[model samples]
Every structure is written in C-alpha cells, then in structure tokens.
Target: MGEGAWSCQQSPAILLAMPAQPASSLPNGVVQSEATARALIDAVVSNELSAFRQGPLSPAELAAQTQQPVYRALRCIRKWEKMGVLRVHSVHKRAGRPIRRYALSAPSFFIPAQVLPLEDVAGIVSRPLEQQLHAHVAHALREVVGLQGSEVFLEPRRYGAFLVSAPGQVWDGSGENLPVLANRWATLKLSYADACAMRDELDEVFARYADRAGPQTYWLHLRLVPETSKA
Candidate 1:
C-alpha cells in the first residue's frame, strides 16, 4: 500500500465500533492550541452530525458539515493526519478517482497552559461565557467597600496559565474581619520528587471536589514553578 493509503480489508464496522480515546491515552493527542482541534472534536461529537460521529468521513462531507471549502477541508485533514491527530480510515474509488476518508485518531485533545498566543488567550477571555463570569465577579465586588480600587485581570505568563490578579486587599461586605479573596505567593525549596508529590497531592484535592454537587460555584487557579532568579 502507498503511504497514507489504507486497504478495504480493514473492517469499517470494527473501526467505527472502537471507543473514542482520551488525549492522555494517545500519543500526539496533546496540542498547543484548540483552534482546529476544537472544531474537529465538535464535528465528531456535535448533535448535528450524530449519525456519522463514529464513522469516517470524506473531505467533501466534512466541508459540507463544517461549512468550509472542499480544498481547505482536505488541507486541514492532511495537516492533522501528519500531526497524528487524524488517520485515513479507508479510501473509496469513485469514478476511477480514489477519495480518502478520514477519522479522528483520538476523540479528545489536551492543550497545555501558556501554549496559546497572548491574543488567543485574550480572545478566550472575551467570549460570552467568560464575559458573564467577569460581570458576575465585578458585581459581587462592587458591594464590597475596600475593593473600590481593586480589579481582577489576567497576567500573561511565560510558563503557565494566565495568572489572575486582584492585587491589594479585598474585604467582604462586612469590611473588617477577614478577606474574601485570597492571593498568596511563597518561595519553596524542595527536591524534584517532593515537588512532584506535592503536585500529585494537590491534584487529588482538586479532583475530590471537582464533581461534587454544590449550590455555589467557585474558581480556583494554582501554579507551581521553580524559581530561577531573585526578583
């Protein structure tokens, strides 16, 4: 078989029946950004394409479903195929021309923090859902007196997720006893193994509460980085 070509002997039924694998389970499943990755995933899991989610699709079919030009669709599929995010499920001969059909190599992808450009990060925060979150947080802070000059904003980071800042002191509506917002920075010295252990422990703590039923929602962000120089 030629490169990128698949034989018809591979059962389409078996391929379609295989369960979608998570990004962590597949090599090359981690991406730097969600741009093309998110769109492809949506194409697979979206209700509009429910009938074909499990099966492979031709570039023309993907173009129609994604509302992109056929050439562009083919180019994207080929690029993803090179990245190992997609693979040829089969090729069909139509009118003596071979048409390639592709399927996602994995259904899910993971994008590491700080991998997106600054503008892309800004674009994400500008989306409707994030805008709503900002509005809600702002309204709640407005009732608290000491936060008059305080503002919550994103701090661009070179090595991790954007750091959210609400600099200076923040007080609850009562205005005296304890602060409602917590922001702390600490310098730690630890062996590599100890650091990894600490991170694993924190992951467990986050996972423990990740799916708990609750009346209120809270956002928590954490980062652990090695210090390179004194500021």
Candidate 2:
C-alpha cells in the first residue's frame, strides 16, 4: 500500500482523545449559499452520489461506493470542505501520511426557497425521475407481452399535466385480454376541511402501496397543486 493508504486497525483511545466539534455548531442541514446548494444538487441528481449522507467516508471509499472516479470524488470533497458543507470527521496516520475522512457537517441539507426559484428547483429534481419513468415504460413495451406496442405520452392541459397511456395498433388489433388505461379528469370545488380530508385519504392510499412487493414495478407521480389564473 502507498503512504496514503489506510489500515483497518485504528486506536479507539486516540480517536476518543481527539477534540470533536459540538453538534450545536453545525448548520442544522440548512444550506444558504447558492453555489454550495447547486454543487450538492448536481452531485445527487447527476451522479447519484449519496455516500456522504450515511457517515464519514474517505475519498477512496466514496469512489468505490458511487462508482465515481477517485479524483472526481476528492475534488467534490475538497470543494464541499471549503464551502463548509463537509468537515473532516477524523484523521488516521497511515504509513507516515494522514488519511482524512469526511462527513456532512450537518445530518442533511435543505435549500431555502428564497435561494432558488421553486419551479426551477422542481424541474431540476424531477428531470431524472421523468427520464426514468419513460425508460421503464419503453422497456416494458418491448419486453412485456401485455404492454407490447402501448403508447405512453404526456398531455399538458390548461390547469394541469396528464400522463396518458393508450393501446397501440398491435394491441388494439388483437382481441386478447390486456390491461386498460384509464383517462379521467374533473374540476372540483371543495371546502378547506374537505380538501384536507381528501389529501389525508390519498396519503394513506400511497402509504399502503408504497413498499409492497410485486411481480412487476410501476412508477406514479401525483401532484395536487392549486390552479391559478396564470396556470
């Protein structure tokens, strides 16, 4: 191993002797800087890197876990360290060189709405989910006999967006039994209490099916935003 290599053996007494930062000193996971927020978002949404959320990890460990290049991981760690989003959790002496482990300064991060536009942030976060949904539908159409030749599309309405799926020519031509896609929309007028009750009911339904095991997997995106004149 090189001078920077770390060993499994660590002295508990030495580790315990090191002065630790008080928990109260941390940022409480709220990130204010736009640059740091953007960097963290990019790391998550783009690379799917989330090792830092678990605990302190060396750059090499992060690279191995995320499948990112070691240099890239180190670069991000260094950048975050400078931005105060990450801190050195501990240092271990290995072959006369000190190996540092980095962890999130806070347990998690929250970007304030004032720091970035809600619409832009939502778009950035939802892009990957949209892509994944499309890819899954495409794969199912190719591989699943029942869903073969089905069409999935998005329809943007005046007040809301709709994702619709329809049987294609092949499926329509065949009289064999297959799953049917439902298309329905309605404008509702409800009191505050009724709206809250509806929301709670929907949440319960979601929670019930959120983790169920199934032979096939599906994705669902539900939004219940208020409709405005500009919408």
Candidate 3:
C-alpha cells in the first residue's frame, strides 16, 4: 500500500481527518470529472461481460447471452482482443467455415504492482460466479484503463480472488455515488505527481453530484498484473 492506502476498517476517520488536504497530492490525472466517472461506472456495473467467458460462442448464442445489444457486444469483444485481455486462437476448421473460438491471453498490466492490491480486488458484480470471474476482469481493466486510480492487472485470475479492496483515503468521502466519477479519473492520461495536485477540484466535482455525501468509506481497488515472471 502507498501513502493513501489504508484499510476499510478505519478509512472513514482517515478521510475526515484529511478533508482539508488538497487533492493535488494524488497521482497525476488520478481523478476525473464527476460526470465521466459516473458514466464509466454505470457502464461497468450494468455490463453483461460477467456472462462472457474465454470460450466459443455462436453469433446467436453471444447475442442471447449478453445484456448488451449485439453490436456493442461485438465491439467490446474486439476491443478486449486488442487490449490483450482476450486471445483469439484460430482453430482448424473445415473449408469455407469461419473460425469461431477464442482463448483469453493471460492479462498484462500497464502499471506497477505498487499502485494497487492485486491480492484483494473484487469485481463490480454481486454474484459469486460473476465476482469470481467477470468482476476480476472488470476491476483490472477499470484499475488500469479507467480514471479514478491507475493500475494494470498483470496475469490471469478471477476477479476478487486477488487484488480487491476499498480506496482507503483516496475516495473515502464517496460511497455508491463515486465509482463512475472515480473511473473517469483513472482513465485520464496524467502523470502520478500532477494528479495529486488536483484532488480538491475532484472532490468538489463529486460533491456537486453526490446526494448528501453518501456513506464515507474507501471502496476503490487499484490492482495491477505484472508482465514478467518474478522470482
């Protein structure tokens, strides 16, 4: 854990104590505009990727199994492939038949492990199955690619199995109302040092959209998977 990395058990008190502190101390571009964060969170929490696995699926099956429209699902699938989150293996097939199966590549992280707790992260989903799988993948992507916090998931593993925890003091004042906003911050492309300087502005942005400072607790998990094997 880093300077802001505390446990959920005492996050509220830590948050209040640090209220006067400037958000500028956070990593560069770590927080985002409130509106964008909310959009990202909504897209994530309501997404049907929880239902998808690194397996074969017919076009009809893919359409029926996901919560998103076929177009969006197709688009997301392609994006995941490009991001190295999914590996599409071309299985040998009969002539004239299209290959229709994919294997997920072990995930790779764009950041360092010090950025997040890879061993304790959980998915955004509520069910055990989703939490174990899709949730992990979602959090990893959100941590690495989204805004609030910056992290990169390193390897293959189910969500929440490793690297899940609250944000501690980072988003302490925000509860359910802050995920989307936080995600936006993570997605922004700022350096860690510059991001720390804008914390107050980020907090204020959240305040404007929040309904009564909804439950103060750290719930953001910054997890990263390493690219190379460690001894």
Task: Evaluate all candidate structures by whole-model CA lDDT and list the values in order.
Answer: 0.54, 0.58, 0.38
Task: Give TM-scores for every candidate, taking all chains together and pairing residue i with residue i.
Answer: 0.39, 0.66, 0.28
Question: Across residues 72-181, which tens digit of lDDT does each residue of candidate 1 receive?
Answer: 87887777676666677888887877998887676555545455444443243335345555676666665555443544534453222222224433332344642254
The digit string of per-residue lDDT tens for model 2 on 1-231 reads 112111111211210112233251237666778776666555555543356555788989988997889999899788878877678889999898688998767645566778756565656656777787677656544543543333444445333433223442223323344333323456778887887777678668866886688876667655555568997
Top candidate, metric TM-score? 2
lDDT of 2 at 164: 21
In terms of lDDT, the best-performing candidate is 2
Provide the clashing-pair count of each candidate structure.
0, 0, 49
- Model 2 RMSD, rounded to 1 decimal: 11.4
Task: Compose the digit string of candidate 3's lDDT tens values, residues 87-106.
Answer: 45445577896655543332
Candidate 2: stretches off by over 4 Å: 1-29, 44-49, 142-189
Candidate 1 overall lDDT versus native: 0.54
What lDDT score goes with residue 30 in model 2? 63
Identify the superior model by lDDT, candidate 2 or candidate 3. Answer: 2
For candidate 1, what is the TM-score?
A: 0.39
Q: What C-alpha lDDT, on a 0 to 100 scale, does residue 189 get in candidate 2?
A: 88
